[model samples]
Target: MAVHSLLLGVVQGATEFLPVSSSGHLALAQWLLGFDEAPLPFDLVLHMATMGATVLYFWRDIVDLVLEWLGGFVSARGRWSEGWRYGWAVAAGTVVTAFPALGLKPLVERMIHLPWAVGLALVLTASLLFAAGRLPRRGGQVVLSSGFFVGLAQGLAVIPGLSRSGATIVTGLATGLKSEEAFRFSFLLSVPAICGATFLELRSVGSWGDFTAALPSGWLVGAMAAFATGYFSLVLLRRVVTLGRWRGFSLYCLLLGLGTLALSVVRG
Candidate 1:
């Protein structure tokens, strides 16, 4: 179990920030490894670990946003600050994302167990990534409209094979935001999304007793591994986006999606 946890943790961390879907890889990894369904608490722990990595990586932006938001209530000048605008932009994106996520939650959960469906979604993700790469490089600011569209993409990525970072970042890029701005907003949006997911999972666990019972001592090892790997993955992804190499990942997703679909058909 410890080994399995470590393996899954590594898989989750490595894929989470890549254009490839982490949830898709995790589902496939578990299926191929014949591992049992991961407990809810452990899954939440792993997610939180990755979330922590994201936070640490963007700690400055987060702190600035928070301070600015608080200052908005205290001074008129703060209301017009850059950080205030950014905070509102993030809020708008989060609100936009929540709608589709809540509406599609059940369907996504059902699709998670269906490898063929996930494969199809991966193909769709690839298409989006490919299109993003081909878009004209007319860089723009991260406005409310761009934020909404990117958030919509993020919401759609609730599906197992739809990569959240890929979808959001690609959408931002295609919408004319600069690579660095797109990447920054993409991760900033993720902070809330991950927190919401953790909250939902925690609520579903019913009681502290059940949550405690579901967690294994070895889960800590997995969480630590996820944090370490996730931080490095974030660094790599930032460089990849900056270098405009995201299309390379699209090709990988395309082949993997097709192969997974074929395998699912054969097994059936």
Candidate 2:
């Protein structure tokens, strides 16, 4: 594998869990490296790898939610269970956040090709991250309406520079959810959304083999690095959220956005 492939994996792993946008970072990285080829299926592999880790790490929570939903369907007192309500909140949030991105897929794809557009969006993402510090904190449980609002933020995050996690976390904070709750829910919600994206890519490309034929070793290295790095990133992010230290991430995004913009202008 090439050195850049390893770097790509690290970037994917590091940013995938952070409020910083992984896709946005990858886009800027690819541009900086001047890679002229398509990086789709391979990109999907890295994303899928992270998605798997997230699911594995949260398997119990996911399983409990499923069981609760199933039992509620079969039992009379199902509606009274906190598990059932939490499950619905998860599902509702997923639908609210992901649906608009699906609807705007074409538009996002088109805009991402324009570096200037991506640069502008990255600036906006930086602004949101910065604003997170000013948002009021919610006590605990996330309200149902908050889901839609967060989803709307996530929808805008389809742009290359915007961090899905950052957008969602900021939205959650703005809606009054505590940082830890906001972070946890953001990760949990990412499972389905990332899977849906990977699946859509695979469907269009036919299979992993097609992508592998061009860059097998690079893809494998990227995936492994992504998994290892992402696992640790998730753990660290949880701790930071618990400590209410999200302001640093805001600064990081702002600096990164500015740096990318500077590079773009220099190259032109």
Candidate 3:
């Protein structure tokens, strides 16, 4: 169980920020490993670990945004600062993302255990990434319009095999934002989305007593692994995006999607 937990943690952390879908990988990994579905508490814990990693990695940007907003309010200059504007853009994107997410929640949940469905979604994700890579690079800030579209992409990515980070970042890039800016906005937007998901999962817990009763030591070890790997993955992905290596990931996703589809058919 400890080994299983650690393996899943690594999967969640490594793939969560990549163009590949973490949930899809997790579902397939569980199926292939013959492991039972993870409990809500354990899943939540793993998510929280990754969330913490995000916060820690982007703490400076977060602090700058908060301080800039406060400065805008306190200063004689009534105009909003650049950071505040970007912050609002992130908020707007999050709001837009919620719409489709709310509607797709049931559908996504239903497909979570369906390997074939995940495989299909991975193919779609690959197409999106491939197209995004072909788009000419443009330099621009993340405006409300770009944010809305990116948000829509993010919401659509709730499907099991579609990666939220991949979808949103690619959408941002496609909309003319620079790679680094797009990556930054994509992750900043995720902070709220992840928090909301964690809250919803926690709220659904029937009993704290029962939930904690079966807590395993492996859970903590898994979470720690997630945090460590998540941080490194973020760093690696940032470099990959900056270096125009997104197409490499697109090819990987394409191959993986095809392999998964083939495996599903053979098993069936």
Q: Which candidate leads in lDDT?
A: 1
How high is the CA lDDT of each candidate model? 0.87, 0.75, 0.85
Regions of candidate 1 where Cα sits further than 4 Å from its true position: none
| Candidate order (TM-score) | 1, 3, 2
Candidate 3: pairs in clash = none
Off by over 4 Å in 2: 36-38, 207-211
Count of backbone collisions in candidate 1: 0
Per-residue lDDT value at 110 in model 2: 74
Error of 1 at 239 (Å): 0.4
Residue 70 in candidate 2, Cα distance off native in Å: 2.1
lDDT of 3 by residue, 181-247 (tens): 9999898888998998889888887688967765565898889999999999999999988877778
Q: Would you estimate the TM-scores of all the predictions? A: 0.95, 0.89, 0.94
- Point out the higher-scoring one by lDDT: 1 or 3: 1
- The local lDDT score (0 to 100) that residue 159 gets in candidate 3 is 90
Score candidate 2 by TM-score against the native: 0.89
CA error at residue 111 for candidate 2, angstroms:
3.5
Best of the two (1, 2) by TM-score: 1
- Model 1, 1-268: lDDT tens digits are 7887887688778888888999888777766667677788988988999999999999998998889878988999998876776777788888989999999989988887898988998898899888877877767877778768988988888889899999999888888899999999999989988898789779889889899898876888889889999999999999988888867889999998998899999999
lDDT of 3 at 120: 89
Model 1 gets an lDDT of 0.87
